[model samples]
Target: MKTLGRVLTAMITPFHADGSVDFDGAVALANHLLDNGSDGIVVCGTTGESPTIANEDKLTLFRRIVDVCGDKGSIIANTGSNDTLRSVEFTKQAAATGVDAVMAVVPYYNKPNQKGLYAHFKAIAEATTLPIIVYNVPGRTGGKIIPATIEQLHRDFPNIAAVKEASGDVNVASEIYRRIPTDFMIYSGDDGLTLPILAVGGCGIISVAAHVVGKDLNEMIQAFERGEVTKAREIHARLLPIFDAMFVTTNPIPVKYAVRRLGLPAGPFHLPMCEPSEEEAAVIDAALKMIK
Candidate 1:
């Protein structure tokens, strides 16, 4: 299985002022991320405001990012949704776009039981030959996929390659590490828990903060892996404020603003996902200054 490197950014979608998908801007941003520190980009994820992006635009964005950055880094498209059939069909389409892999977030709102979750993912896993990253973010999904279910999926499907464990509980990550095979990767879905999860054998992070502090984040990960514990801890401590600020007002809001502040391509947000308030933008500004 090809690992989607150590620091994958759950990238923000760049939009035109008219609220149209900025295809050219997205290409620029993907290259910018690759040029910086991201090993890959997870387009159309939560930070990318997947909920608001149209399906056609999403496919286009996936293809565009892959076209520009596929050779430079991994491009993992966010193709999952709360609907199983829809997710399966979309995953198949996303796979056709040449992404390195596809991530299926745990079904949100319509909380599914373990059996249902298993079946839902099974259908998606069966639909594609590409690697699948099972995204388990309970805070947004309204339910969590237990380690047992993940283990079962890993065992049953070779393509069900990894889990983005963002439940915010280190014990959950530890349990997942204990159950899954060594080859089955686990990624920190929460930026705050990256080091703790790594201590428990996680492979890397699917991060939001990497948009601003990609180089520093990558340095921290490399420091830990190189036995520079103190150095890693120092970097993590310095980045904690930025991590908190990213969530100061729901993800992407602070991150999008931070990116634009850097004079990057991040444009205005789509409906229901507007820009940060004055107070929130101040917090994000302070946090961005922390990046060294």
Candidate 2:
């Protein structure tokens, strides 16, 4: 069960003045993230304004991202939606495009039991040949993908390759690490948790903080891998404040603000996901500056 290594940027969706998807800006961000140190790119994640994107638009976006990434990074298509059938459809489309993987979160708003969570992912797994990564970010998705379910899923489907553990409960993540197949991967869905997760045997992260702060993320992982635990922890500690501020507002909003600060073409956002307040942008800018 192959999965991503090190960190992958959960890119923010950029938009033009008319609210159209800014394809050019997105390509630039993807390029920047890869050049800076992102091992992969998780396109259309919750942090990427996923809900506001339409099915047709998502198809094109996935295709475009795959083309843009080439082999520079893994193109992890966030195929999850509120409905099982819709999520499956998107997953199959994502597989058709040959993306590296599909990240499916538990159904949101209308929460489901463990059986339902298992079945939702089962349906998605059956739909696509691409490896399925269960994304557990209860803060946004309402429900968590428990480790027990992941253990069962991996047992049943060899293609159910990994979990993105963002629930922020290390104990839960540790329990997951204890049971899953050795080959199956666990990614720190939270940037702040990457080193800790790695210390506990996690692979790495699918990080929003990495959208603007990727070099340090890569360095921390590299240091740890090279047995430089002290240096890795120091970088991790310094990165915590920026990581906290990145989520100070909801996801892509703050990331988009940081991208604009980098003098990128980041502008306007999709509905329900607008730009941060001037004060908020300033705070994000200050954090980005400290790292830069």
Candidate number of the best TM-score: 1
Minimum summed lDDT over a 10-residue window in model 2 is located at 1-10
Candidate models: Cα lDDT each: 0.91, 0.84
How high is the lDDT of residue 9 in model 2?
86
| Candidate 1 colliding pairs, count | 0
lDDT over C-alpha atoms for residue 226 of model 1: 95
Model 1 bad stretches (over 4 Å): none
lDDT for 243 (candidate 1): 93
TM-score per candidate, in order?
A: 0.98, 0.96
lDDT by residue for model 1 (119-189), tens: 99999999999889999999888998999999999899979998899889999889988997488889999
Report the lDDT tens digits of candidate 2 across residue range 231-275.
Answer: 999999999889987988887888888887778766878878877
